[model samples]
Target: MTDPSPTNFAAPWEAQVFALVVSLREAGLFTWSEWADRLGRQIRPADGPERTADYGAWLTTLEAILAERGVAGPESVAARTEAFLRAAEATPHGQPIRLENDPLYRP
Candidate 1:
């Protein structure tokens, strides 16, 4: 049976993550088969069974692969993530969130 319900990304970040994976693949960072294998392992770790459509796992897998390929270090990603979090928190409701909005952000 197939789901009759319309399927779409629940949030903008989900779409962004999907696009990022596609863009990376298109750029030859990794083959589609490699991506599927890594994503499968990520969703179904040795400690558990396959999870259903978890985009968080997708993001994690992307991060891991990027780090492995030396595209982005974990420290840089973490710092950027933290900066975004701070900026999001500092931004007023209905305003766009920018890294510059972060209180600790300089230049």
Candidate 2:
């Protein structure tokens, strides 16, 4: 699902989500400490040491924060997420995904 470059990331989407978090904070939507608290609460891995990227959870939390702050509706985020997944699912393996429009998960 990924052909990564030289980076310590489990998946490409993790970097995208991380970048979105930083951008949101830069846009004054939330503070870094608040993100720490929220993300800490969100991370409850079943296996304590089986570490891997959890971009799905990260994106879910991000959407929740956006909803809490009125930056975007939860339904909107869900719709976009579903569409993104649908696009990815339809794409052949090892090919680039193509979304119908600009993603809602970006700033």
- TM-score for every candidate vs. truth? 0.87, 0.63
Judged by whole-model lDDT over C-alpha atoms, candidate 2 comes out at 0.75
Worst 10 residues of 2 by lDDT: 44-53
Best by lDDT: 1
Q: Candidate 1 residues 76-101, lDDT tens each?
A: 99999999999999999999999999
Task: Show the lowest summed lDDT stretch of 10 residues, model 1.
Answer: 1-10
What C-alpha lDDT, on a 0 to 100 scale, does residue 19 get in candidate 2?
A: 90
Clashes of 2: 0
| lDDT, residue 24, candidate 2 | 89
Evaluate residue 79 in candidate 1 and report its C-alpha lDDT on the 0 to 100 scale. Answer: 98
User: For model 1, what is the error of residue 94's alpha carbon versus the real structure, in angstroms, after optimal superposition?
Assistant: 0.6
Tens digit of per-residue lDDT, candidate 2, span 1-107 = 37565665578878899899889899988888888777766675556643322677678779889898888997887777687887787777898877743343343
Candidate 1 backbone collisions, by pair: none
**What is the Cα-based lDDT of residue 55 in candidate 1?**
81
